[model samples]
Target: MFEGLKVVVGLISFILVYRTVTGNCNKYLAFAICAIWLRFFLAAFHTITYPPLIVGFSINALGSISVACLGLLVIPTPVFTLKKFFPFFLFFVCIAISGFVNMKIPGTINVLVKWCYFLVLASALILSVRVQGQNATFKKLLVAFTMPVALQILSVVLGQAKATEADGSASYIGGYNHEAAFSMIIVSFIFVVGLIERGTLSFRTSLFTLSVFLLVLVNYRTSILTILPIAAVFYFTLAEQRLKPSQKAPVMMIVAMVLLSSFLALSFTMKERFADIGLLLSNLDLMLKAPIYFSDAERDIMSARVYIWSQYIDAFRNADLLNQLLGFGPDSWKGRFNLYAHNTFVSYIYEYGVLGVGSFVFVCISVLLNALTLKDRKLSKILALSFVGFLAMNMATMPLWNIEGLIFFAILNAVLIGHKKSSKSRQVSTDNRELLNAN
Candidate 1:
């Protein structure tokens, strides 16, 4: 009976989220759909059978192919010269060669799953841009992206209540193993929403402040600390408000001095909490302990990541041209029991080899480039900060490789990328246009 209930609930949740993402049918909704699917696939993989691998791979490969086809269907065929195509081609080739040469194909199913994910993501991005001409469309996309998250938050709160009442623990299913990471992802989205919704500073500040407090409760120090400072800097930099000419230089100088002093003080205070804040507020010392404790684990669990990375590096060294392309096919890292490289850099190397890594890096660079191109001051700051957070969070962990991590990264990417195009409207733009666009 319990099992039946679980299945029923899962189905309902899945349907709700899917409709939330695709019903409005914007490009961003497509991105949201893919992000949710990535979470589903990763979660479902652990529970599903092995023989079904072929079926899963076929479905996902078709999805990727479909994305490329769909993009062509909607948008102008992205003109590709040999110069542009050659580099892209070679990059995939290197990834394939490295994986095949190393025989890192045990997790073939997982790789296929990711391919499907990327395919869907690509398709969603294309759709999002195409539907941009409509006003109601983007609002629907944002609502689709956010409303489910709001529901999830409510569900979590209810679960927490039930757990407390029953003296039992509540677990989030569907690829969410790390509660801290999952909470951080949700918080990241809220941060994005706050950016899109322009109101008084007090309102925005209160929202982010509350978010920071909740983050502390969740104890995702890496993401909270990383994202908060970046978000603040990004927000302030992009904000339209500026000091008068007389006060500007002195204010800037004071701020610069405070920042410099703080950095120097932090560097000296490493591994020790700063005296000013209590256990709840000060995290610099705690940040140092994860590595230290993990490094000292009895079974050497943390070192396992190093061992896997070593094997991958050696494989990359031996890889050749054709094998270097297209990747060793997906899910190439299964059976190792080590879910990720514990580092996004290592994860990229193992999954895409050098080529896929290059492409991934290229995409990040593209986002950064587009961030600068943003017309709206607030939107640009938010994109820049999101990117910074995305990159920063990877320092200690690979949220991108895991469901909890990927959801945050994927949603943020979808929203920020959407902002890049939508921010084109200037202050003098049509009121009708203003009413239609969300960002």
Candidate 2:
């Protein structure tokens, strides 16, 4: 029964991607959005792979290709700017150099190819959004992105799907094969919250409520922590402008009650898993003083991540100059530690080196600053807040390399940057009109 459902869902997903790509007015943008959602289904089906060369073909590669092809076909005269392409260029060069130096032919080829695909996808998204309009494209992309997540939620509720183990223990999976599901939910929530703030979507929607429930089920502590402050800020912001004084008190009381009840319910249902967090917190002092290299017993208590991070730091310190500046190539960490760095920043540094990491950071900061300077201050604030949430989540897990999470990251950032560019163009046009009228 489960297998049949998976096949049905996968078929529908492919049809949707095909229809959106070929049928939409803005085919390039639609193709990109469709490809992003396609990752969700692909991951679920476990069909995305590159065989003996790279094992699993990433959603990044699939989505990138989809959008890149659309751009080539429809926008034969597509524009490219150094401001947009330079950072990616530097980062890819670093990876290629590192890969060649390391002599990991398969890994090197894989990294180079994936990075190129990502660059193409990013470029296509920005160009498509520029030719179209940001507001319309964003709304369409949001709807398309939400569909697979809704399906996933349904599958889990229907008992057609089960979580995969994160550690040796099964508790961390939270009913999905990868932790990226948790990140996806968080990103989706950010989008929903932005919509609510804009008055485009109602806060009381069933989908939003169900999403909140799924988030709690996922049991990602960092995401939970990030959501609290965002929720509070969102509520306070909205209440001041949108709510009556009488309505504010009751709304706050209701929210508090709901949160408290949810916490109590999770505490009882996930006692053992929650206890692991409590134990980790209780042993914080011991953890700091413990040896850099932990024993199996020590690792079990510390969740093995501390020891892994320590190993990564030591390896980086001990690497040769060229490797230190460029990195030891993609997936090189797996050779030494048998696992990827759980942290995104650490992973980037390990795989792409100081120069690559620097370029990536510069691009992020540039987009953020551009977002902040937007005339639509509300959306700008939401974008800025969402980026902060993304960064906070990245500190705990490496989502940039994960297919589903990378789709969310790439799409969200691309939309924001495209919107910023569009806004500037409008400002320039308005200024030109004013000058002509004065003349």
Candidate 3:
């Protein structure tokens, strides 16, 4: 009976995906995003300590390989759409180059596969929006996104979280393996959800926003930097909609007060995080430059991020000119230190070197600029703000390094690409109209 039920559910899901993509877009990109919820669901089993279970590893790589193979199927890539993100393409090229130079084929292929995943996923989503229409596409996205997040929250609140901090504190990551990635996803969720449902702060919206603040209060304090500005934008926009021009200042004050109050109310619980601010400020210079080595005493500070980042920085400083410009290679830090760089920028500079990090920064700048010029001004403003938050995140953690961060981006960017071209979707046969030309 259980096996039959599994097959029935699989069939239903397959049918739903088929209808959603209109038989043109392949299923894996959507399946991968859908699988993210599954990853978190599997985390529940990991949370079990009674007998111990080893669930499947993340499917992000599998998803990437699957969609990337679409290129092998002769579907032309959306080269036109991808041109807008050419800098990112350069970043990928740099990674592959660094890998070949360093002779790390597995590491090189891994990053390349993820890039291909993003490429094909973006193409598929853009086609879905064009074929399924904005409301339906976003509705499907909302449901897909909402479940994992809600389940994650429930897991944390119930104390089933398997994630912990370097200092052995509860991170409240719930189903996520890391707190920073979860926090980044929260930021993305706010932006994407708001994009789908825009209006004054309904009771539900206000409550959801408050819940996010509370959740962050208990874990990943740095995320607060990104959340504050983005949340303020959304909340203040409500003030604009309802208040008179003369009342704008007071409404802004109120928004600030609301955010402040949320922080203050939870201050007692996050005393350690607040202290980290002082720790970082006091050691600002050392944080940037130090010897490639630290004693055990120094390694315990700032959750060892200070020591961890310094090793990466000092190595980059001492690297040969060629490696300095091109980077040592993908995941090179792991071989030396047996650890990932806690800071994304620091990691990129050491691993991919100047060319890789520069291309990444350029991509961020170009995307932000183009976001403003988008015909859909509302989406432009929200997404640009969200991207800022995402950047703030990258300063401390590698949001783009994880699958959750990529999922929301693929959705929002797909909307940005297809919303305007929606008219052209009607030009071809229903079957071929929204087809992915995945180059």
Candidate 4:
């Protein structure tokens, strides 16, 4: 069953990349879709199935770098739009400098390459919208996400769910190496379908989100923190505004069905997971109510995320002025403490410095502002609200450290900013024509 599922992902990737290289499909769409599979599914699957190393590097590194190169080749010319893209450019510049100054040469180079890959990915998404228009591009994204959804369902059906080391817990990994990674993928899919294609409620999207939420419950519990508030905003959108009264009823019914079904499925399908679920509830108390300090108990909270964060902060606080400004270096945490800080701000602040973390936050703020300004109100609100969940994720886990997480917000921000830019261009053109007629 595992081999069969791997075959499915392989075939899907081959078909998409072939269509793209052959000019049978949009290069941006095909490449973006295939990159997700390559980055999220294939690399890990390839490793365990065979010798993952060529020379010294793992297949994961090789495959991701190869895909990054392809993205650069297929991407449009880089856009330096201040709010849309420049913040990322500025942010990566900080990363590069910190990497160089701190002498983390090899790791910094690898990190910068990934940063470049992400920039290319964002550019490709924006170009797709500008050329193909929003509706066409978003429809493809909606279709693209179904592969993950299918894999999730199949994992459950075939009983191929992987177990995490903690308490030998069964994680609904859905063909990915880690359930956390799978949860991140589902979060991206939610933004793709639920927020990106707002107001265009369809059977495909409704069913997709239902499975997505259900699978999320059975996977990494951190995503439950991310998805719940977004789900609330989603429900409110369905009921309070966006759709007309006539259109609201069925969507509301769908929302109710989705939530109820997801919980019921969780209860029946994952009885053993209840212990983990109980931990999730308990952790929520630590996460929300417990104040993070230098205490040992606080350090132990949320899988010791707070502890690591406090340590990272303490280290950063004690560092010299140069190190404080620039950071000890990219990925320096592993060298300094033998573990990742596990929180985005904590990790980046220590490794990339205050300046680096500031730019990173700027990129996020830019996404929120861009999403808020989008022409689609439902898309705007849901996406903006989803940012709360995103920020929450960053506080507890290092979601930004992964390609899927970066690409998720990248695609979203691209769509938001690109659509706005395209609309503005058209309006300006129309205005010019009207002026000429008046003259």
Candidate 5:
């Protein structure tokens, strides 16, 4: 509820400022900053709480309200097709069906509600992207979205100084657990938004730089260790191949240094024991077998998940031909097994069976291809990095299953899928028009 309050206030503040700016757009951006700041704080603070609730509706409310705002903004002016948003609507329908079919579990209804919240967030973000113009509104949206990174930085600081030294602390930060997954997902969102906004305004670029610094402090070792190096290599190689010779050297140098510095800083902080890899690995090997690391009690909980997954697999495999095609129903899984799949892919398979999985895979591939089609060399590189980094982060932890992570991924996919080929085209058109008039 505390978190819910923050979100509600943030949205009201943003709406008030949006009204006050009188079309300035920049003031509206300040409102976005406040909203995002509140969101990040709530998400970071609540990561440890089970069945995370909307304590302060502020974090949850803004996205839904913002979607409505986008709808209103675009209804008066025609920037993008409202129909382009239909696929997203279809995607949510699938999620709803999945939830209802699996409703037998203890908290299945709550999960569905959370799913609805995430869908609203995804819609809001996608709508915001669609409504973007040369106007300042889109920039403000990105600025507001970046606010979460600030909260992550604070969490990382606290997490670093006093990480939990026990196993149930799976949700604690900088502890090589799931919290790191959430942190990395939020950082990836910030990183991509920064890249997109780099040329928008000097102030925005400065904010981008600040975001990078804070991201370093947020220190999710797995993502930092992988994304930094991969992004650097991708940036330089892609830039060298794509940009003009004159434009290559400067960008490469700047990107390289930022990635390197961030990588080193994060690595040093979270992985002090990794300072001695051989010893750390040997100790980790023993730790895995120790009572504290894999206690009987903890093992039992994990084993229960295994049991649930097994039941899901058996149910599907043994289903008759028709049931296999249509699926068991959304709430069916919860009723049948008393558990939600902790694994996202498993969850999808349980709900939709093969056909649903196929459709999901199709959407994913479309997003990937769309990202590849991005013409802006910089935006292209950023999306590529995010896709790879995000996928890797999700392997060990359930980013897709986490509400915050779901919003982050869905928004990111929308950005990648809906991002228009502009900036360069607009610049060239402006230059050509000026030349013709001069002649």
Candidate 6:
């Protein structure tokens, strides 16, 4: 069957990617590149589920294993301090306990295994870069991060160029699947901000701009709303720093021209969808009040998200003490609600419980604090801003456990936190050297 073939192909891909990572190549870069491909491309190929034994087998699972292995191979020692490791440990333990007590054995094991994989992989990535040195590691990571966006643009162009049906009706899935457009937009936004912070915008401006245009065309409204403001702020800030007064106007004009062209193109290609935006705006108040004031039919017009959220609230309120304190288990919401919570915080509370959710919040706070410590660094500030944006996006979207979101979050946090530690160490070394010289 095709399911078996998918598993076979995934294994082969994992092997090749693992070998590439372990080889003389830049291991961190190789892992980053492979992670992106596995998350966006290979994982999209198939989903194989046999239930209870192995719930889901996909390229993402294989990719996580390979990256974890690479991390273990490169660092051969514990790289995380207790402060950095405890929250995740507590969170994982809570999930395990919650699942076991709930008798959701299969889901508990699945959740634990996946979290273990993510933990090892994230830790390895941070330590691997530490061992490799920041300058070299950052350069490789930048290329690895940008490569997918570049390939995504190429895929979109090729897809657009392909001949359509005899009736001349074209399907506009473009580069990635339509379902994944929101995730692509988030990654692309991060890429643009990261490159700008690194001072490589001039070299990559056209490609990044094209990627952004395609992402907008894909038309995930929440993603557009979340990313655009952040992108604009970061872009203008970078422009101010990098452009001379004499050059700023021309650069700004070029940006405006490109944006206007993209808007016109979208308007022509997707007139109805654009009109729908206006319609939605007109009915915004009704949409907002639909859950309480309007009829069921009107609530359905809002795509049922508000209704679903209401159901989640009801479920939480009626949960047993154990479920309320710890949560049912990972993926356990489906058994009761027949769907995902569709909100990360809701999912966390429903699946991982209050303890797990609190641990996650603490981890996020720690990352923000670390970012703030590097206040003078523009990249750190931009990264902190991006993290906040990502967290906000999670409010309306359940991206916490998904492969693309996990990989993006892990890589960004690892790189930023690792850099912070390295900077501190360097400063301490310099101070010691100065003391010695003075003595």
lDDT of each: 0.47, 0.58, 0.63, 0.67, 0.49, 0.57
Where model 4 places Cα greater than 4 Å from the true spot, the runs are 16-24, 44-55, 78-83, 165-169, 196-202, 239-299, 421-425, 428-439
List ranges where model 6 is wrong by over 4 Å. 1-26, 47-75, 131-135, 142-151, 158-178, 181-189, 192-202, 243-294, 421-439
RMSD in angstroms between candidate 6 and the native structure over all alpha carbons: 6.9
Candidate 2 lDDT by residue in tens digits, 87-187: 55666676677777777677876666555445555555665556555655555555554445555566556644344335433223222355555446445
Q: How do all the candidates rank in terms of lDDT, highest first?
A: 4, 3, 2, 6, 5, 1
Q: What is the C-alpha lDDT profile of model 3 across 220-305, one tens digit per residue?
A: 77676667666766766766667888988887898888868866766666776566657777877766667445667667766777
Q: Tell me, what's the RMSD of every candidate?
A: 8.8, 5.6, 5.7, 5.8, 8.7, 6.9
Clashing pairs in 6: 326-353
Q: Which has the higher lDDT value, candidate number 1 or candidate number 2?
A: 2
Model 1 lDDT tens row, 168-211: 33433223335444565555545544544444243655555455
TM-score of each: 0.57, 0.75, 0.78, 0.80, 0.59, 0.72
Q: Candidate 4, residues 337-407: lDDT per residue as tens digits?
A: 86787788878889889899899889888878877787767667777777878888787677777776777
Higher-ranked by lDDT: 2 or 5: 2
* Residue 371 miss distance in model 6 (angstroms): 2.4
Worst 10 residues of 3 by lDDT: 44-53
Candidate that scores best on TM-score: 4
Clashing pairs in 2: 49-57
TM-score of 2: 0.75
Please count the clashing residue pairs in each candidate, in the order shown.
20, 1, 6, 0, 29, 1
* lDDT at 262, model 3: 69
Deviation (Å) of 313 in candidate 3:
1.0
Best by lDDT: 4
**For candidate 5, lDDT tens digit of each residue in 269-376?**
545523433343344343224233443443443323333444566677677875576466555565566656545555666676666666666666665666778887
